[model samples]
Target: MYIIQKLINRFFVKNKLGIFSFTFFIVIFSSVVMQILEPKTFPRWFDALWYVMTTVTTVGYGDFYPVTVAGRMYAIFIFLVGIGIAGLAIGKLVEAMGAHRKRKEEGRLTFKGKNHFVIIGWSEKAKYAINEITETHPNLEVVLIDRLPVTPITHQNVHYIQGDPSIESTLIQANIEEAQSVLVFSDDSIHDSALADGKTLLIVTSVERLTPHIHSTVEIKREEHIKNFRHAKVDEFVLSHETVSRMAVRSAFSKGITGIYTQLLSHKEGENLFEVQKKAEWRTYKDAFDGLLEQGATLIADGNDLSINKKLNEAIPEDARLYIICSKDVYEALA
Candidate 1:
C-alpha cells in the first residue's frame, strides 16, 4: 500500500503531464495491438480504435470481442492497463482544472474583456464602488487590480487581476488599453496619508501614460496631492477626508441633507446623478430642462455650470453635456 501510494503521488500528483502523455501513448499502442491480435473481430484500424476508446472509458458497447485464446489473454491485459490509465488521466484532468480555478480566484489570472472598468487598489470605499457599479451597470464588465493575493469582491461581471496597478505589465494583464474607465483608490492600510496618496498618484500617472483619453477618477487623502493628479489629467478627484468632513459639517447644520446626498449617490434605490448628451431640439437650458422634466428627470447642470438658478434663456452650446438627477429606469427611458 505504501509503495502504491508513493507511485501515485510521483506520477499522478507531481508529474501530471507526464502521466497524461504516457496514457495517450498506451491508448494508441493498445488500439494497434488489438487490431493486429484480433483481425477477425476488428477488420479495420478504425474499428479497433473505437473499441479501445470505449473500453478505456469503461463504456463498452459489447459489439466486438476477442474469439481466439491468445486474443483473449491480450484483451485481459489491455483492459487492466486501459482502465488504470483512463482513471489516472481523468483524475489528473480534474485536479488541473481545480488548480486553475484556485489560481483564478486568487486573482493570478489575466483578464481579456474589453470596454470594462478597471479599479485599482482595495478598501471599503473601493468595495462599495464596485458593488454600486456592478449593480447599476449589470452588462458592463469590471476588473479589479490590486497587489493583494485574494479578490476583494466576487461578481459575475467582475474579474480580478492580482498585481501592482502602477506596473505596466499589470495594467496590460487587466487590458487597461481597451478599458472604458479606471478608478484609483488610495491605500487605506498605509499608516502614512502621504504614502497612501503617493501610491495612488503613481497608479494614476501610470494609467494616464498608457491611455491619455481614458476617463480616470482617483481618491486622495491630502489636498496637496490634487495638483499632482491634475497634472496627470485625472478626470475627477475624490478628496476622501475633505469631502467627508464637509458633508458631516453640512449634515450637522441641515438635518436630512446627508440622506438626500446618499439617495442621489446611490444607484440601487433612489434617483442618481447621470449625464446625457445634448440634443438638437434643446437649444437653451430651459428647453433642455423642460424636455428632461417631461421624462421625469430633473436637469441639474450643463457641463460644469449649475443649471439651478441660471438664465434659462441662455443658449446651450452644441457641445454642452447635460447632467440630470433621475431614477435608473427614468434615465434609461430618457437616454
Candidate 2:
C-alpha cells in the first residue's frame, strides 16, 4: 500500500501526462471490476463503463447501480479518486490554452510561413502600410516586428513579433529569409533625422546580411542620407520628409495635384497604378501600349522608365516590368 501510494504521488502530482494516464487507467479498471463483481447487475462491459463515466463526471444519471457488497465498495473508491483527477486534467488543459495565448501576445513565438512581407518598426505609417496590404490581399500574411510589449494591431493576415529587428535572431524569428520583401520604416520616436536614418540603415544592413537577394525598401528622413544606404543593397527608398515637401510644393503650384498623387499612390480609390506582364506576341512598346489602351487601360511606364511615348517604336525587352494605370475592373480583365 505504501509503495503504490508513492508511485501514484510521483506520477499524478508532478506530471500532467501521468495524471491523465492514471485517470484513464482508473476509469477503465473500475469499469472492468464493476462488470466482473456484478455480472448479474451490470450485464455488459459497456454498461459498466457508462456508469463509471457518469459517476466520475458527476452526471449521475441514476440508470445503473451496484447490487453487491464488493461492487459497492469498489464504486466508493473510484468515486473519490476518478472525479478529482478528471477535474485536475480539465484545469490543466485550460491553463495550457491561456499560456499559449500569453506567449503569442508577448511575441515569443516563431513564424514558419514563407513569401510573406515583413515590416520592421511600429508607427502610424506602418499601420497604414499593413492596412493597405491586407485590404488588397486579404488572404496574404504580413509579419510585423517591433519592440512593443504587445502587438499593436490584430488582423488575420498580420503577425507581430516583439524584438529588436537589427538583431539576426529577431529577423530569423520573423522568418525574413523566406520573405518576399521587407519594408523598414524610420523610427518616429527619434527626434534627430540622422539618428533615425542611422537606425534604419543598421536595420537594413542586418537584413541584407541575412538575405542578400531579398528586395528591401526603406524610409529615409533626409534625402542626403540616401547615399549611406546604397551599400546595404536597398531596392527602394521613400524619402518621407522630402516626398511630403515635394508633394506640398506641387500641390501649391498646381490645383488638385495632391489628388493625383494620392490616386497614384493608393489603390483603394480611383484608377490606381498596377503592374502587368508583357505578353509574348507584343513585340514593341506600341503594340503593348495599344493593346492595353484598347482594354481601357493606359500603359504609362515600362518599369521606372515612364517615357513610354519616346520608346514606343522600340522593341519591348523580355524582362520588362510594364506598369499601367486603369480601373480595378480593367486591370483584373487584363490580368
Candidate 3:
C-alpha cells in the first residue's frame, strides 16, 4: 500500500497529465504485448489482436476465442489491465468534452441562424423577457450572452453563451447578424438601477453600432432613465418599476380587475395581447376587423388605448397599431 501510495503521489501529484498519458500508453502496451504473446500459443495473431482491440475499447465483439490453457490465462490478465485503460481513456474523453462545452458556452464559439432573438445582459428581467417571448413565439430561438455562468433552463429552445454582451465578438456568438431583434437588460450586479441603465445603454449603443437595422428593446430600471435611452434609439423601453407600480395600484383599488389584464399580458396559455400591422390591402377598419375575425382573432383596440374599438364607418388611421387578442398559436397562425 505504501509503495502504491508513493507511486501515485509521484505520478499524479507531480505531473498529472503526464501520468494520465503514461497510463494510456501502458494500457496499450500491455494489450499489445498480451495479444502478441498469447497468439504464439493460440496460433491466430490477427484474431487475437482484434480481440485485444475490442476488449480494450469495451466493444466486446465476441468473434475471437482463447481456447488454449495459456491463452485463457493471458485473457484474464488482459481483462484486468484493459479495464483500467478503458476507464482512464473514458475519463480523459469526458474532461475534453466538458472543456469543449465550457468554451462554447463562454462565447468562444459561433454559429448562425435566421430570425433569432439575441438577448444581451443576464438578470431576472432578462429571464422574464425570455419566458414571455418563448410563450408567445415558441419557434423563436433565443441566444443569451452575459459575463456569468448561464445555467440551463427547462426549455431547450434557448441557447446561452456566457460573455460580455457589450463586446462585438460576444454578440457574434449569439449570431446578432442574422438576428431579427435584440433585448438589452441592465446588469443586476450594479448597485444602482441608474448604473444598470447606463450599462444597458452602453450595450444598446454597441449593438446598434454592430447591427444598425436590427430592432432592439432596452429595459429601464427607472422611468427617469427613459429619456437618456431615447438617444440610443431603442425600439422599445420596458419600464419595470412603472409596470409593477401600476399593477400594485390597480390591485389596491380594484380586486381581481388587474389580474385579468395581467393574465392577458403575462404571455401565459390563455388570452394574449399582440400588435399586428395594419395592412394597406385591407382599406377599411371593418375589412381588417372581419379578416382578423375569420382568422380566429379578436380585435382589442388601437395601441394601448383599449377603449376605442374601430367603428364600422370609422376610417382606419394609417399610423394606428391594431391590438389583437388571441392565443399564441392563433397569433402565429394568423400573423
TM-score for each model? 0.83, 0.88, 0.67
What local lDDT does model 3 show for residue 128? 84
Best by lDDT: 2
Query: How do the residues 147-175 of candidate 3 rate in per-residue lDDT, one tens digit apiece?
Result: 76644454667777777778888788778
User: What's the TM for model 3?
Assistant: 0.67
lDDT tens digits, residues 1-335, model 1?
99999987887667988788888888889889888988989899989888888888899899987788877887788788878878888988998899998988898888888999999888888889988887778899999988777887778898989987888999999999999899998888897989988888888999999999899989889999899889989999899999999999999999989988898888765778999988889888899889999999999887778845567889888888779998888888877
- Sort order, TM-score high to low: 2, 1, 3
Model 1: lowest-lDDT 10 consecutive positions: 302-311
Where does candidate 2 clash, by residue pair? none
The prediction achieving the highest TM-score against the true structure is 2
What are the lDDT figures for the candidates, one per model? 0.87, 0.91, 0.76
Looking at candidate 3, the ten consecutive residues that score lowest on lDDT are: 40-49
lDDT of 2 by residue, 214-288 (tens): 999999999888888987789999999899999999899998989888888898779899999989879999999
Deviation from native of the Cα of residue 20 in model 2, angstroms: 3.5
